[model samples]
Target: MSLHCPSPATMPPADLPAPAPHTPIEDLQALITGCLFVALSILMLRESRLLTGGTTGLSFLIHYLSGWRLGLVMFLVNLPFYAFGLAALGKRFTFKTFCAVGTLSLFTELIPGLVHFDRLDPVFAAVMGGLLAGIGILILMRHGASLGGSGVLAIYLQKTRGWRAGSVQMSVDVLILSLGLLVISPGEVGLSILSAAALNLVIGINHRPDRYFGF
Candidate 1:
């Protein structure tokens, strides 16, 4: 008779615990907080007459050019993307995205009345606004929601082609900001680029698919 035991070096590694699934209540809380942060960022940018990137930036440009409400323009701009979201991301993702977009639209409209900034420096606005928006977007992404527009496209591309969403978004934003050069001052364009970098850096660092498995 012989007894055998596996050596410590040959022992199998233990499995890591899976992340907990998000509850409906957790999703609702994240949605509200995310929208609030994004709305606040938009308010700061509006006050400073600064532009950002993505569909939100496009909304700001339209608002400046047409004197339309930013919230209304943002909501409208995101509408066309829902079809793509539904087709590519399925029902639950699209529904959460729709809720997120609608909540952001309403919050952007309402925040103006609740908060007022007498003087906002362009540099401060650009940096802080970008950070806040990035955090908001991170929260949305973790919960499987998005702000729509290019975000939908980014997610679709990432899923289909194994691309990084942050990289996709940054490329689109660069093009959009280039167009912004025609309407906004060159100085503001530079600041807008800085803001875009800040926003994308957050996504690039924290939103990697390999690292985050919640969504």
Candidate 2:
């Protein structure tokens, strides 16, 4: 995401904003697929004894420390962020994000009962998990939705203050992943960094504001 969005009124006649809203069916499908991908990424990270960043990473940290269900914790951890999302991103985005977060929680809880991995490679898990999470987030962002927390803030900054969403996201990830060290080993933290890099790389290269027009 880039920082220099020209408002329709201020833009030249040839550069006016032209955002085509998503259809209900398209949004529903995207919400489902995006949440499912993030859920699967969480599963991979959990099984491989790793964590990434953002609210998901925070949820993992709490889950590791509290022996709580990751899905439930994730849902709860995202609660307060809804207020900021509603204020900054608008009602439609907030509503979609609420549903997306809830769906992700449900999927994370249910997927384990349906799938299992006896031996997951850590390196593969880190890369694939990051990629999956990145793709999921990209889908949501394109549809005027986010996973809440820093995702919302990232988008808001891009839309209003002209900050790069990818850069803002990575900065937050660095902080959250640093805290992961308290709960995980140094090596696991390194993998977590790799995952964040892969995840943000997708966002940095593909989700630029110059390319993204949906609102």
Candidate 3:
């Protein structure tokens, strides 16, 4: 009680604590799943020419216009969104998303060379692609990794403006699909919309917090 300490103003500022590092196991699992989902999505989408939402959807749109690899376009397009993610979602999320997006891109490029289906049916492709993409998305969500396309914007909007990620993502997807009306017929656009709807349904239901815990 007698001793007097230095004034609070004179004291040095406390060093900020570092963030908890993600385990290698966690990172590895996320990467694997992300890549798998992206690859499968490409396979499915290529068969049906259907578009999903997010950066991937944009990638598909560009691919449709240019006959380029959707996977490559997906990776390239999402590169810019990483910065937004880092600023809004923090380092851990940014890193995970980066890893997921990069892995997915690489897989997209590599899968085509390695795998091919002989008799491709558009309907089967659409449904399976939606399922694979949905499953892949679920994996990334569980591990805190994102594809980092529209998702980056969605996250930012949710944090800063209190918007819903699902709604933001859906809107972007719809816009992307609308562009298909020019190149693809109304029937194809309808199918594309259906594929996207299926993808969203899977992500929404499986990714619920209370239902599927334990990352």
Candidate 4:
């Protein structure tokens, strides 16, 4: 059965079931599922030569400018953020974030060879990629993990300080996409904004504290 958390203002009845920690199996599947969605979204964005938000977008910029492997760049770029996650979010969260980052990097490397799209429309790719990314991120967050970088900070602020994760992420996303003008075309940047909007909208609307009551 699905577990919907009670509102913060509402007290559970005496016999209400206590929230249980996610099983290792559940976390593993969630990591795989979440990363796969993000991996596919990355492929779509790469095909369209579009930018995304977060360190992923920064990695894309470096990849474009240096002609380096995106997976490697992505993994490296997210490295320092793990330390911050560990300090701010604790061990399990940081460990899962680390694993999530590695798995996403690996998926980004492998998915391209396995899946091919002959003619992916740019607009659809932008929106669909954003939607997939949002869903993926939501899965990771609910499972007590994140993609590192701004994601870690966003979650930290949300949990400790009551800031909206989506808002924090959205602000950073705008700056990163704005910086995209240095590498990508204005038109692509505009589309990237649409993608960011689709992404942040999902988080803004759904990632509330009372939505889930588990770590």
Candidate 5:
């Protein structure tokens, strides 16, 4: 008896296989992650008198300058990105992201009044805020959902050209943070940068590829 491997001629066509479908549990996890992302974002923003990076950060910047509701600004800023995400990512990802964004917007508007963090010390605020936001972002990532800022572009570039998501995110984050120079004082800019670093730090340490695949 001889052991033989199938030749290329006998191999199954790649196109004939269907993509694996996500289960209900996966969807529930995504929704829970989205809720956490929103809650943490609002908590961070309110606690630190600071902003998150990416489009949510931009929304805060706009709110600071214009007195508009932060949630409204977030929703508006993210609108254009939805189409971009749909094209670059996929329907499931895009839909989850959209839901995440909406939930975040609603929470941003509702959480401030419901939960107060007015007395948190600035240093503690920054550190805790970053930690919470980092964990929340990690959840979104695990579920194939994004908050729709630099994240969208990061995934797009990663897929198209085999770029690392972290590098792309860092580049976009740097650019977005630079905008703070024009809107916020230099000292606040420094704090924002620190908070941003903390967010990435958690992501870097806790979300290693080997450990991130499961819930």
Candidate 6:
């Protein structure tokens, strides 16, 4: 007797349907990962006395001026954008974004106790922090959420006008970084621009609509 096994050419075709958007469990995992990375990025920026772009950068500016808690400032700064998010993006998207923002706020506050940095190079911090933040935001975007603030506007414009979210974000970021000249030194502002460029490069390259299929 001879035994027969199916060879690759004889097997069924491997074509498969596109995957459905993330389930709740997967979304939760993404949220956790995104928040942790963002928190770490913020910590690196803080340690290095650097700032990136967007509303988070505004929070940093406020924190520097007022000596308030960065996490709290960031959370409050993001609150006003929820209305726009709800109106333009819908209830589900806005709700998920709210949760993501809250998680990030809490994580930023708690991370200091969990992680410590004895020494960090400013240039290294700027580049790494920007990259991590860009990746974290990408995760949030893929999971149907955002970090709020200008992110809401970016998504809204993308959906309504076909503008790229990353490009929109980069424009806003450059404006915010320009404002940094009032508070931070010109050299620091230059570093912030570099960091923002790195962050936006990630978004521009990877966050395009054609690149990702998930909601």
Question: In model 3, which runs have C-alpha deviations exceeding 4 angstroms?
Answer: 1-22
Alpha-carbon deviation at 39 in model 2, angstroms: 0.6
Per-residue lDDT over 1-215 for candidate 4, one digit per residue giving the tens place of the 0 to 100 score: 00111234333344767667789999999999999998999999999999988889989889989999999999999997776677667898789888989999999999999999999999999999988898888888778777887777776677789998668876877788888999999999998888877776776567666444443
What would the TM-scores of all predictions be?
A: 0.85, 0.84, 0.83, 0.85, 0.79, 0.84
Q: Give the CA lDDT, 0 to 100, for residue 119 in model 3.
A: 82
Order of models, best lDDT first: 4, 2, 1, 6, 3, 5
lDDT of each: 0.79, 0.80, 0.70, 0.81, 0.68, 0.77
What would the per-residue lDDT of candidate 2 be over residues 1-215, giving only the tens digit for each residue? 11111223322245675555679999999999988888898999999879878888889999999999999999999898787677666797789889988999999999999889988999999999989988888887777677887766776777789898768877877788899889999999999889878887877677665554554
Count residue pairs with overlapping backbones in model 6.
0
Residue 106 lDDT in model 4?
97
For model 4, the local distance difference test gives 0.81
* Residue range with the least summed lDDT across 10 consecutive positions in model 1: 1-10
Candidate 4 vs candidate 5: which has greater TM-score? 4
lDDT of 3: 0.70
TM-score of 3: 0.83
Candidate 1 lDDT at 52 equals 85
Each prediction's number of clashing residue pairs: 0, 1, 0, 0, 0, 0
> Ten residues in a row with the worst lDDT in model 2?
1-10
Candidate 1: list runs displaced more than 4 Å. Answer: 1-14, 155-168, 209-215
Residue pairs with backbone overlap in model 2: 3-162
lDDT of 5 by residue, 75-190 (tens): 89888877767767778778877887788788778777777755777666666767777777766766666678667766667768889766777676677678878777777777
- Give the Å error, residue 174, model 1: 1.8
Clashes of 1: 0
**By how many angstroms RMSD does model 1 differ from the true structure?**
10.3
